[model samples]
Target: MARVVWHVPVTTSGTGSTTALRLFRLRDGRRCAVGFSSPEALVALLGPDQAHTELGEPALRALTAPLGIDALVVDPRLVAPSVTVPAATQPAAPLAPAPICPAPAVRLQRR
Candidate 1:
């Protein structure tokens, strides 16, 4: 069996090919893809602490940003000293209420 692994960069497109998330099986002489949106759920499906890493910053951000509003997983182009936050996702646990991201994730959905 042949397998390829990927970590979503922005979760929009991926390296070379394999742009979207999917499962594929060789049919006839062709390998075709099937789309699946639940990487986190898939991760769960794969079992605990399987040891994986995400690829492509743009693809990853696109996949995660929308769904993971309150909880963001950033894959920056470069290391950041700090970043800005929106208001919705912020925890009121602080004395000074920090802002959370208001813009909803554009792509991808969370399970």
Candidate 2:
């Protein structure tokens, strides 16, 4: 299971909403984030009274640094990478065959 190392609790104000960053250490030794995501959007999709904790900035930077990622900025006006349907321009890459075990399997009977 993925674990949250650092997070900020999200709370709503009178007319405004507040959200923070989140850093997650994935089960496969990878890191993921939700800082650029909006809590309001999450609530909209998941319905009202949703439960989640936002994350912090410093912790995010620290975690991303080791992975050669300097920062994670959110650009609202950013455009999608592909606008039209995708097509394969080149031949598909080849994959290596699965490795075989060096030792034979061993079985023991229970008493």
Candidate 3:
């Protein structure tokens, strides 16, 4: 069976969070396995990794009809880069605390 894969860029609703959707399509199958680059985002929505779905032919057609999806998934246009985390995703360094001054010692008088 022939299969097609696509990486579609998407943004979450009202959150401005951006990620890519990984779609796997099989010519003879009815269901598709939907995946995302950020698993955290998926957990936030579905609370699990169950991302598969079955959309009918019309729905699938409508999904790709506008984007000219065929062109984007073709060879030569898609390139897989080495897996590496971008600087923006890295954790920021913890801030250092300000130094405190010592209190002066007082002399005690005899009672």
Candidate 4:
């Protein structure tokens, strides 16, 4: 039987010697390690700019277990909502004026 290898995304530091595994957060705020079956699959979700390395399931699990991440998401399809910037031609809404309040009177006590 052929061993299955997963493509794991990583971020490289200077000289590429120091690399850190890329991790994602679940909707419930739990951290998870993400992997894909192939390079194409990884690129499809993370874009072409993402760097990845191949690792066996055991290796992937071992790497993340020490970090307290037990969830391993394979070929995850969930994506965050994209941010939209308002056009420059559109005018912003006016701000409301602050409310004016009368100053409180305070009596001073002589010691």
Compared with the true structure, what per-residue lDDT tens digits does model 3 show for residues 1-111? Answer: 534332233334355454333444445533343433344544554456434333334444566556554312221122346698666866889999988989889899999
Cα lDDT of model 4 by residue, 9-99, tens digit: 9999979789899999999999999889999999988899999999998999999999998999998995779889877996879988989
- Regions more than 4 Å wrong, model 2: 1-34, 41-53, 75-78, 81-111
TM-score of 3: 0.23
What C-alpha lDDT, on a 0 to 100 scale, does residue 73 get in candidate 4? Answer: 90
Off by over 4 Å in 1: 1-39, 57-111
lDDT of 1 by residue, 1-111 (tens): 534334322223335343444322333434332222335643544444433444443454465455432222222122335786766975567587678869876887799
Cα error of candidate 2 at position 106, Å = 40
Specify the highest-TM-score model's number: 4
Clashing pairs in 3: none
Q: Which regions in candidate 3 have their CA more than 4 angstroms from the true location?
A: 1-21, 24-48, 71-111
Return the clash pairs for model 2, or none.
Answer: 8-54, 21-55, 22-55
lDDT scores of the candidates, listed in order: 0.40, 0.52, 0.44, 0.92
Can you give the lDDT of residue 35 in candidate 1? 22
TM-score of each: 0.19, 0.30, 0.23, 0.72
Per-residue error for 24 in candidate 4, Å, reads: 1.1
Q: TM-score for model 2?
A: 0.30
Model 2 lDDT per residue over 6-90, tens place: 3232345566665433444344546544343566655554346745655566676675577665535431222337578789899
Collision pairs in model 4: none
